[model samples]
Target: MSKKVYLVGAGPGDIELLTLKGMKLLNRADVVLYDALVNPEIFQFCKDDVIKVNVGKRKDHHLKKQEEINELIVEYAQKHETVVRLKGGTPFVFGRGYEEVRFIVKAGFEPVVVSGVSSTTSVLESFMIPSIDREFSDAYRTITGHDMKSFSEIVTQYHSRENLVIMMGIHNLKQIVFTLLEKGYPSTLPIAILSKGTCKDAQQVVSTLGEIEQKDSLFFEQMKQLTPAIIFVGQTLNATQELIAK
Candidate 1:
């Protein structure tokens, strides 16, 4: 029998957001490797005897290295008829699903990708924020806040009509805010941090580049607890305010 692995997206920390196909695969999976951002409640779909492994990674902690995760997927595929690699959000959207797929294919196993709803858009929508609105924004840019150099290179300047959706940015919120300021982004530009999006305890912190830059270290420290958050900035945020006023 040919070995196969399913790369499934568990969605943005919401159990109901999981795709039907993903849920079906989880129900039949003999082994599952899930990420940190994935809701633990999602595992309820799996069989009672399923083998579940936590291969999640946080800011400074990793349960399993990428290499180990890759090898484990292949190893499990050899013994289990159904092995599922459950990830947060879509497999390819910053989930490192492509790398895992490549490794699995090299090991002679077939890899199947099941796309999930990405937090990039859904998180903003959850807070009544539109990523792209004709009245405010014409386009949106999604980027990672993990690397300062890459971030600076991409966000050369700010456009009022363009919205920015930043992932994994809570850690470097201070620096990110300063970078935007240095890059000619207006200090008064509206920005919002949507944390633990789609989860029950989800919260939103709204501010501006200047205000966030001036926030005390204590504020940033507290923000560290809110991982997997998105830093959204653009004029489109005003639209939400307008709707609320009416």
Candidate 2:
């Protein structure tokens, strides 16, 4: 039997946001390996006897290492007719999906990619914040906040016409804010931390770089509880506020 693997994107947090093709594949999956941020309700579409594995990671804590996950994908693909690797947001967007694809291809199996909605932009839109507005920003940059070194290197300076959408940045919020300040981002530059976007309990914290810098330890402590959050910085946020106010 020919071995084949499907890498599916589960969208941000809303189960409804899942694409039609993704949902159809999930319904027929014989085995599924899902991530931490994927909506649990999505599994409802799968068959009752489907094998489901939780290979999720959170804040430096990994349930299964990357190498282990790669091995499992190949192992399951060899046995199952339909193998699905479900990931939160899009697979390639900070999901380490390309690495998995590389390993699967190396194992001589066909790897199919099914694109889904990414939280980097959808989360911002959920809060009425455009990733890029014609009047405010002409472009947007998406970066991961998990690595401070890469972040510092890429975000050396601030651009008023560009927006920054940072994922997995809740834990390093303070450092990210300080780095922006050091990189010449204005102290009053508008920023927002969007959490659990598209879900019923979604929350947002709107503030400025200077204000966030002055936030007390208690504020940060509270922020830690809001994991799986996205940090947005740019003038587009101000534009969102102005439109909402009027």
Q: CA RMSD for every model?
A: 0.9, 1.1
In the range 14-126, model 1's lDDT, one tens digit per residue, is 89999999999999999999998889999899999999999999889999999999999999998889999999999999878999999999999889999999988888888
Give, for candidate 1, the lowest lDDT window spanning 10 residues. 1-10
Q: Write the per-residue lDDT of candidate 2 for residues 46-160, one digit (tens) a residue.
A: 9999999999988778999999999999999888899999999999988899999999999999899999999888888888888878999999999999789999999988888
Error of 2 at 114 (Å): 0.5
Candidate number achieving the greatest lDDT relative to the actual structure: 2
Cα distance off (Å), candidate 1, residue 190: 0.5
Q: In terms of TM-score, which candidate is strongest?
A: 1
What TM-score would every model get versus the actual structure? 0.98, 0.97
Q: Which stretches of candidate 2 lie over 4 Å from their true place?
A: none
